[model samples]
Target chain A: MLKQYSFEKTAVQTFPDNVSLAMRTENLQVFYGANHAMHDADLGFPKNQITALIGASGSGKSTYLRSLNRMNDNIATVTGKIWYHGVDINEPNVNIYEIRRHIGMVFQRPNPFAKSIRENIVYALKANGIKGKAELEERVETSLKGAALWDEVKDSLDKSALALSGGQQQRLCIARSIAMEPDVLLLDEPCSALDPISTVKVEETLLELQKKYSIIIVTHNMQQAARVSSQCAFFHLGHVMEYTPTATMFSNPQIPVTQDYISGSFG
Target chain B: MEQTNFQLKKQDAQSHEWDARLHRATRATRKDWIGRGISYLCIGVIILVVASMLWFITSKGIATFTQNHVSLWKFLSGTNWAPDQGNIGALPMIVGSFAVTFAAAIVATPFAVGTAIFMTEISPNKGRKVLQPVIELLVGIPSVVYGFIGLAVVVPFMRHLVGGSGFGIISATFVLFVMVLPTITTMTVDSLRAVPRHYKEASLALGATRWQTVSRVILRSATPGILTAVIFGMARAFGEALAVQMVIGNAAIMPKNLISPASTLTSQLTTGIGDTIDGTLPNNALWSLALILLLMSLFFNALVRFIAKRGQLKNGR
Candidate 1:
């Protein structure tokens, strides 16, 4: 565990400084029992820019994302130091719920609660103790509009969220995440399960969200990485091989591994 | 000439091959029908057993309910239940069953739910393994043993304190509380555990406290399952015979106070086990009274089923 922690710590040190570093990790190592998932990984996510983490399956990219909000706490025996606004998130005093409120996550699968569409949007607000019917109604409308789903679901706000189409459910999840007005949004392969048109719509939503929230999206689609992200980081076997502007990373080719991955030689 | 000879032989061989293939298909079809027949036979057997049990209860107990004018209403609303006297009131017994079960539920629900939460969500890995086997063993202990313990220990203790006939609603209820606790506790835990992990994570991510998440998200989602568990416990409490009968003082009169000796429906049946009714009229009425009890139990069961059915539909939606 100690050795793996240092491995991630060294990896995080390799990134260059950017103007708006929303979240910074210094030597983050994650372990489940004896297996080391993420080696010394260091990276910085800039504000208002869509940063995409691209890697093959089992490359530790998702592990790094979950560690940001301490979602890994439930897994038992994970070691890492994640820094958000200069506070070490691993500190005993650091509340995980508060961290997650600021850094919301959208899962790969659309997991709408067994609740009405309006209630789904209002769940987070109610959890935060936001009441008053008028305020709740306004926030629900705004969040749905922000997610680009209001026009589609406005007439049936009272209908069950589970009754929505797959694409709509994923978008509803997005609305739920954004309703909290989080500082950073973490999306783990959000469009991997959707059809092509739905994928395009979700990508567009992510691009629009980049103006307000720092977005870290993990995608297997290189074209998507090229199209949506402002910056891209390529991870290989728990190591961050390259981090650069998406244009440069895709066209110019900084590292050999990144080039190999793009050319489809080996993941 | 060559074509004529070869074609004729080929046609003959082809007809034989087709005949063999058709024979094999018929055998396979017969096997499938036999398999389906066996499945249906098993189902039929189960349905038969259930129907026969209901039939037997109605046939035997129906006469007891239709015997006398006093027996019919008196069994449910009468102030006294005594076969020795011409009067056979069932109100005291009904009250006895309800009071004891209500108290038992009040005593056990919180403890059961609390234990369930600790076992499923809050307990450490090591503790979780210990919890299941312990609870399962608690459930396996026989009801007769429970009766003996209540008689030897609880009745004497109640006598010293609450006074009265020593064996009364207080002792019977205390024993029922212990008896019914495992049912609610186990089911509550199972239901809470059945809720998806996403719900918990969603609540946690929103900065809510652990207690808040459990109360708002976990418990609310698991309400139907927990309610079903409580309903099962209620059924068990009402039907419990030996343990409650042993502890409750066999007084046929309705108690004016909690300390007074009282009887339950089961107790009345046991106390009046085998005196031939004055005639078939009294016997039939007695059977009807028994049927009424059955109806009451069935009513509560249907209520639970209704709640459960609605919960299922909502979840499906």
Candidate 2:
């Protein structure tokens, strides 16, 4: 099975000099006890843009995305400089609780809290010391509308979120995240558990959100990456194999591994 | 034509033989029937035993009210409890039981819930491994031993501190607190552990601190279980006999204060049952007191079941 394919190990590509980045990583590495789960990787997310991380399972795309928000602190030993607003969030003294407020996330499965839909949206707002009833109600509507779920759920805002279908629950998760008005929204296969119709709806919501928030998504569906993202990064063996425009990456991949992976030779 | 008729006859005979064998095999075997019969008999025996116990207790408990012509309302509301002079009022004992149990619950709930939270959430892995078994070991200690310790240490200490005879509601409450702490803590830990990890993760992702997540989400989700734990502890305190009797000073009178001597239902039954003759009014009155204690226990169990059922309904399970 060893073909005469030359695999190049080059530095990950960066955005152009003039493009301002919303968040980026510098030499990010993750370790689970002794096993080096993710190698040192550097990547940039441009402001107000959609970037999709595409990789096979265990290729560390999800790991890389999770590390950006410091979600891996309790589980793994992550060492690297996560640069946002001229501060390294990887420092031990940094308050991860405060940092997470600015960088929201949605997990793969739809994990809406076992609370009412409106309470789910207002939970973080209340925790952040916003108590005005008028302000909470206004923000709840805007967030749900932003996620494109206001029409279906506006009538039942007080109903338990678990009563919603899987797709609605996923959209509600997106709504819950955006309710905090974060600068960066990280989604890890947010549509993997959804049907095609729900997938398309969530993709549209992400596209609409890109006007106000920089979105970084890790998706298994290659067509979803080509459909929605402006920039795409192909990860292989815990490293970014190639970073390019979504159209070019789909149509004419420069790396042999990327071409083989996209063409379904080996995923 | 002759060969085809013979073959058909042979096939029909063979099929009939096979059907006969199948019918015989499908019928219940002697062993199976015997086992089923034994199972039904065992169930019947259990029902009979429970019914007999209930009938006996009910018959004996109602004799004082019906045969002895004692006024049920006065027996419940009257303050005095002298059995010899025809005064069988149980108000003091009922109030004493409730007061001691309530005080014990108030004293124990916070500590037990805190210990449960520490064991399940905040403590390190090794510490939890060590602490959980140690707490479970506390439950294995005998109630009499706990009572003896309370009598020797807690009662004397309270007498010195509060300036009254040490046998009272406070001393009994302190003993019951120690007795129920392990039970409530164990149950609370189990319920807290039952909460899905995703709930905590979602809260943490929203920038909430661990404490906030535990209090708002985890505890809220586990409210039924925590309530069940508290009720179980309260039930145990309510029914406890030896330890409470030892520390409570067993004086059948209306408790004046935390330090004044009092008597619970169990304490009165234990202390008075020995002196009265069988089938007498005094004995029957004690039996009625026992029936009340039984009813209280049943009520607590029903409340626990109701809370659990409501929790299930809310969860839509």
Candidate 3:
């Protein structure tokens, strides 16, 4: 039997006035047709830090993450303010294509184009009107190194990406996204499909990436959140139930729903 | 008492049920046999029919060379085609077939790809609701109707533009273009739609514009399928007879220019078959033309299969 918990009593942490945020959402309500998926999810992500969104399936963690860069523009109706660089990017008139350039995204599945690894990394670069051969080669080397895939795939940069293992393909996807040099990177369960060894490698890569890019990840693994993220947000039934330091959320959850979820009593 | 009785029943059931044996044939089994028999019979009949047709055509086609003494090289390279005067050079019809087929495919490719892209990537709902039926209707329309329209409208238009009888290669090409456009466009749309949705999402998430995503990602990935569609369209154009015949004027002569009258392999076969006597050289030569058409279609099918296999390999499927 699942116990009913009160939705009104919640604990949401807020940052200090001096803390610079990479992005934030205010009164963010998402609707798929008439189904309200997310409601008033006001949260701030600190700059240059990893923030993990943890929840059960269909809890709107992915919906909220996708909306951070307006990836849900045509798929759903979002009525809220997504502030990035002090501009409300949720506005309809805003250029989403430009917004995506600054805030790249990685999907749960590694969708490497059916091209060579070099071509995969440089395709978006070429599309953005960069044509210098030496520059493209440089970016390819750096981005692949950044994603920690260069050492393994350096010899076969011309090889088809589909030839890579699941973990390698996921890293290549990360490399593809980061090749654009985005400010903030959003990952939607990026490591869920990976094995333990690959997961560790990806986690290590994420830790290394934190020094350069702000990271926001949605993960189902609580241990992963505690291991990687500095701050953690736990979502339940599309509501932001708890937001606190990763250690505190796992060690001492301030709410009943979060406590049960962490204990694996229910999700 | 009831428990003991149930245990005894279980023991009895287990002893016999656990033994390996087939059940008695029921009415359903009879019906199953009948259904299987019917399907196998249909397949057997079709295979026999096709094999016999191949045998008939090949035997009759080869009689021209073995019995009538026409050189294969001369027949292929000969510029003149007159069976009555013992000049059975079929180069004009061969060239005419290729010209109309190539011309139609070249003109139809851009329009087909554009329409396919519009249907798949741009306004897909409009494409499904409005354009899909229109394309299907075009496919359903009989070739005779299309040929009649060409004879009535396109021929006169060609006459006004080029100042000839308007029955020539150009007119036949226009007719074949209309006939093959739907075949190519529909297949192209299917191919474009077959591209995985994730490729588009990945491209868009990289901040690529819609046009950039479509041209660089979607169209590139669909290249094999699109090429197959073009080849299939060319095959259709190459084999179309009534439509080309209505506009080609059936001259059976060398096509001096695009505006001059000529005949395709199919056109000559259709019109000349009725004029020649049975077991004669003229009839056997016509059979040879049919053989060429058959070989060309088989080549097209082989090409499609090869591309599909290559595409599968590239995708690592």
Question: Chain B alone: TM-score in each candidate?
Answer: 0.86, 0.95, 0.93
Per-residue C-alpha lDDT of model 3 across residues B1-317, encoded as one tens digit per residue: 99999999999888777563456667889999999999999999999999999999889888889999899998899988889888899999999999999999999999999999999898799999999999999999999999999999999999999988999999999999989999999999999999999999999999999999999999999999999999999999999999999999899899999997899999999899788998888988898888889889989999999999998898884
The candidate maximizing lDDT is 3
Candidate 1 residue-wise lDDT, A116-228, digit = tens: 99988888788788998999999889888878899999999999998998889889988899888999999989899899988888888888888889999999999999999
The CA lDDT at B201 in model 2 is: 83
Give the lDDT ranking, best first: 3, 2, 1
Candidate 2 vs 3: which has more DockQ = 3
Clashing pairs in 3: none
List pairs with backbone clashes in candidate 2. Answer: none
Put down candidate 2 lDDT per residue, B52-78, tens digits, no spaces.
988888889999899899999989998
Span of ten consecutive residues with least summed lDDT in model 3 chain A? A1-10
Q: Estimated TM-score per prediction?
A: 0.91, 0.95, 0.94
Q: Candidate 3 regions off by >4 Å?
A: A1-4, B1-20, B23-35
TM-score of chain A of each: 0.92, 0.96, 0.98
